[model samples]
Target: MTLTRPETAATPPETDAAPPPRPEYPRPDRDRSERWVNLNGRWDFEADGHEGPITVPFAWESEASGVHRTWLERGVYRRTVTAPADWAGSRVVLSFGAVHHRAVVRVDGALVGEHVGGYESFEFDVTEALTPGVSAELEVSVTAPADKRAIPHGKQRSIPRDDYDGVSFTPTSGIWQTVWLEARGRTYARSVALRGDSLTGIDIAVDLAGDAPEGAEVTATVLGTGETAALTADGSGHATGRIELAEPLLWSPERPHLYRVEVRTGDDRVVAATGLRHFETRGEELHLNGERIYLRGVLDQGYWPDTGLTAPDAASLLRELELARGLGYNLVRKHLKFEEPLWLHEADRTGMLVWAEPAAPSRFSPEAAAAFEAQLPAMVERDGNHPSIVIWGLYNEEWGLDWDIPGSAARAEAAVHAYERLRELDDTRPIVENSGWSHVRTDLVDWHYYEPKLAVWKDFVARLAAGERDDFPVRLAPDFVVDKSLYGSAEVPRSGIPIVNSEYGEGFTSLERAWHLRWETQELRRHDRYAGYVYTEFADVEHEAAGLLDTWRRPKDWGGARPADVNADTVLVLDLVPLAAGADIEPPTGPLALDVHVSHHGRDSVSGAVHAAWLPAGTPVGVPVPKPEVSSGPVTAEPFRLSSAATITVPPPSGPARLLLWLADESGRVLARSFLDAAEVEPPNRRGARPGEFEDAPAPGHAWQPIAFDDS
Candidate 1:
């Protein structure tokens, strides 16, 4: 079935809601109290000496900022503030959560520090520039080059590529995150890393900066669990220890239990939340806390209509998580961009699993590689403590790397280097070197195939399941092949790595969209070798209409079964295949012959019967579609149980028609349902026959062909 021009409901009006208050200590990993000041409201932005007001943290291109412009050259932010009387004895540290491309900070007309990377946080010590009871003038000059290749900007196009369309977004420039002033003692926690292991419990490491007093010791306490560990700092001021919990409350999608931690040394204390769980792949299946897991995930591009890349507030991020959970997705693939700490903190709090990726660099070069690698350690270190981030996506579709070269030695070598480098930074999580359509050395075998043909897709998956290779266009790269031998070699080589379809199916009508989702998910459920799958996206962005929700975050109903129902953790799937392709009926149409494919995932066995019925167009049948008189015989121990439904009839409709099939339990509770659009054929007039009525040449034959999706 093909649906064109899918109808969409009206979206809510855009609001000029006031920006919410930001937390003083934006970084949860290393938080501080009275010493921090939020400088996020409005700043004096001078562009070419013309002064104007621009929101500090919000991107200038975003509507949230009064100055709704794209790229600004030679912009200087000037501000002045007096130090609080209480902070007389402490040193002042100026922090910029993030600035685009490059930024240079000056205090009292003297250069203090400069930062090149746009995605990572940077700080400058302004103690010497500040005088007691005096006002300090702060100025930051930012430059964002129009050349996209100069920086590692993900999904943002300076000059649009031929393939770049509405699927992506516009570029963001200068200070998209929070900027603030922090006052601290001479000695403080510079950074911290936390990891949870089932065997060893939880490990915490603290890196102290400044002249730490002698005999200082770092003490960590697990808030509610009464678990504590203390380690004395060495001369260099670094401390490490491990805390063992009494009873492990393993974190999962169902119950996201977190252990709050407090670490203190000297006058400074750092607080963080972590979950005790392990995510690993055993053979072809993913195990969470030693139990096999089927990841039901959605592709989330962290963009807001009004705020651009930055979410307006913490509540908005929470709402997004709530929506995903309500929709039956246990995981979210943070496509390309690394999201804000607030969102990541919310994910940890709400128990949403995330696959975090670095922002993709536009092109390949030695300079680009250096810039990209320079930012990975800081990114991983800051985000490593969050348990929601289970996997790290080092590259995406070979964005900034030369993976298309023949033999692809450079790409393969780069992939291995990145994988190994990230492993050294944080060995707690697996790494996807290049998320889709390529594999040199990766923890998972992932591919992006938008195969729309159902039968062809099914045959390809079947061949993979049978441990046979097929020439079905499985390439090492999206545009070319790197290693034909390594493609689908996981199953053949019997590699313990798991497999995921990272992306698939974009832009379909409501009915077609719903049907396609069910079919693709069922295919994965039937194939136990596959670990899990992530749909193309959660919401539509710009011209990409394939999202389950519109750009405004409004939900859509595609067909009989809600998208959530089809994606639930434990549910039955009924695949109906008609025996005969063409059936001609006039006034009295009889039961149609169909081959039923019954399967269940997230459960050992399914005790259900199949029901076949017909409903007219626009009819709202109860879900899991209403059960009919034709009951399924029995379910088998096999993954997909096939049976035949013979001679179930349906009455003709006034307009267009539909045929519905439902899987119901023994108690007549509907588990799942599927339907097909029906169009009555006008019987050939024997009295005056048309020229090609019986030729069967004009109309193409209809067959059940499955669709494919991608993981990222």
Candidate 2:
């Protein structure tokens, strides 16, 4: 094929200052070599009669790419590289970490290959077209259409919509990850699946790419354990084996122990890590390595302001993982986006569990069906080896499924087919057919509840357990789940799957978030049938200001409560805030009388000193309050006991002030703390009545009518 170019010649990028060094090779499973070359520098780009140098691997819609325009049209990339003389006998492989939508490649005026799917990796063997020790021209034509329904587009949009769109960020196109080239033998290990067996050891499955000689065998060696297994390849070029270890150190959030395994086939070898662990659901609870555990998780969207879908650097990924771990979160629900392998590798090393999902197209059609069906299985196969990923989320909130159409068994069938395909691909982890609603043939009954009132939330869960469902209006489609599940169809009974509040808490104040989280978390803990919970998000995105941290990753203080005070364990609770974090006290000015509630969630008795004080907001670091009082005298306490109506009288101060309460142990270490702002803050969700306003629970069969399409 002849090389085609636009009439205008491309110019230098907008800025001459050096961009940060390109991120290191992002594919964790692929083997590394000194013979590889990084093609991530400036590349000539052209689109819509405009031409300029654009940064490779950074999408055109981002500032880091030196071109922040999203025209939703075709763009071209061109570069030149000289082939290495030492790579004469090996195959010259050109690999793309990921290219958005579709791409056509040409090398030295000859068409080499074409790849579709924006979120997957692809490679081409270009050795036959390369001249030894000579430079070869390379070009790539990419197309990312504005029609969001046809492709697997995550939370991005050509035109902003309501709620998650304008509040969310912009969409990205073109190359959004690293691009590189390397030389490999004719026959290589294409992929490997590693599963841990507690009693035996590790199970190894290998898939090969090129031709292998007769009698060729694949071997797996455990690095530190000195265990090895070898198996001969069958006619299909696949092999399986098992390695036994003398002692096993199972992986958990508390202690993340990973065992490295090296797989060799023919002249090729690849190294990766895995921990001996399995995640499954039993009766009403989720178990990790055969022990029941609650998932204290935060939602991560994996988007950045400057780089679009890419992180600024390797350390940027590490910082987010470290921050989540420091805040006592053991798992992160990677919302919507299928993250790069580098991020998943870090999660494995840091011992963080992940709930991975495929990015959904905006609308449903035959094209959407084909696109999703093709990509979902590939996503599972590509990410199956990572030990951190425990759950495969098939769909989310019915984005692409046409549930509104009457008697649309096709929509339901498509969802079930995807779930079955995933199970066939990897049977190690549980599958969530649909995340929020319209769950069909799923292993878990996951839903969302965002009512601001704690008492209402308690009632909702109780109603669900009693076979009476309540309205989940937030983020639900008008015609959602009408006849999709057993709740509507008589053919299927209430699947009785384990329940989890997958998403909640989008807009709440510091104090409200603290109190609401405490109540909701304790409620789940009190009920064994509910598996666990995942809060809406970890940090704020664009206009959504409901994160524990702002967009720039700065922590928004939780009234005065620290991380340990709100974590799952500790077992201490207090409620002294006169109103929600940003609400005004009714009196507006005077000596205020505050009645707080306190309770211990532990099972053993304890003794501690309760300290209370009222101080101005801007008091000096070490300066003490003018006059402090003891709310509760030091005394022995019994387990599961409640102390209600504890009052603390505070004289009105000259300026804005706060009341601080702390319960300290014998060593003077604070076990629990709560703070109340004297003045009204900003943007509180104190919408209607507070908790307990509707004092009585609904009668046995009187399930709150679920909001439906026919109703408001």
lDDT of 2 at 530: 62
Residue-by-residue lDDT tens digits, candidate 2, 73-191: 78999988777887777667788878888999999889989998888777887878776577998998999887666567777774434222433467778988888877666676667
Please state the error at residue 280 of candidate 1 in Å: 0.4
Error of 1 at 489 (Å): 9.4
Clashing pairs in 2: none
Kindly list the per-residue Cα lDDT of model 1 for residues 1-712, writing each as its tens digit.
0111223221112234744234435766455754677777667787764578777677777766666776565578878866676777776788887888799998889999999887888788677787547887888898887677746887766663412222457777877888887777667667777788563478888777766644577889888767899887777777888988777787766677777788777676667777777998788778778777777888888776656777665556557888887777888898877787777887887888898987867667767767777789878877888888888888776667754422456655666678788888987787887776557668887766554545555666666666675223433322332332225223233456788776655325644555566666766666667777888778766555667776667777765546676676544443442211122122234455555555444535555655666666546645545546465565433332322322333444454555666666677766665555555555546667687454322111011111232322
How far is 590's C-alpha from truth in model 1 (Å)? 2.9
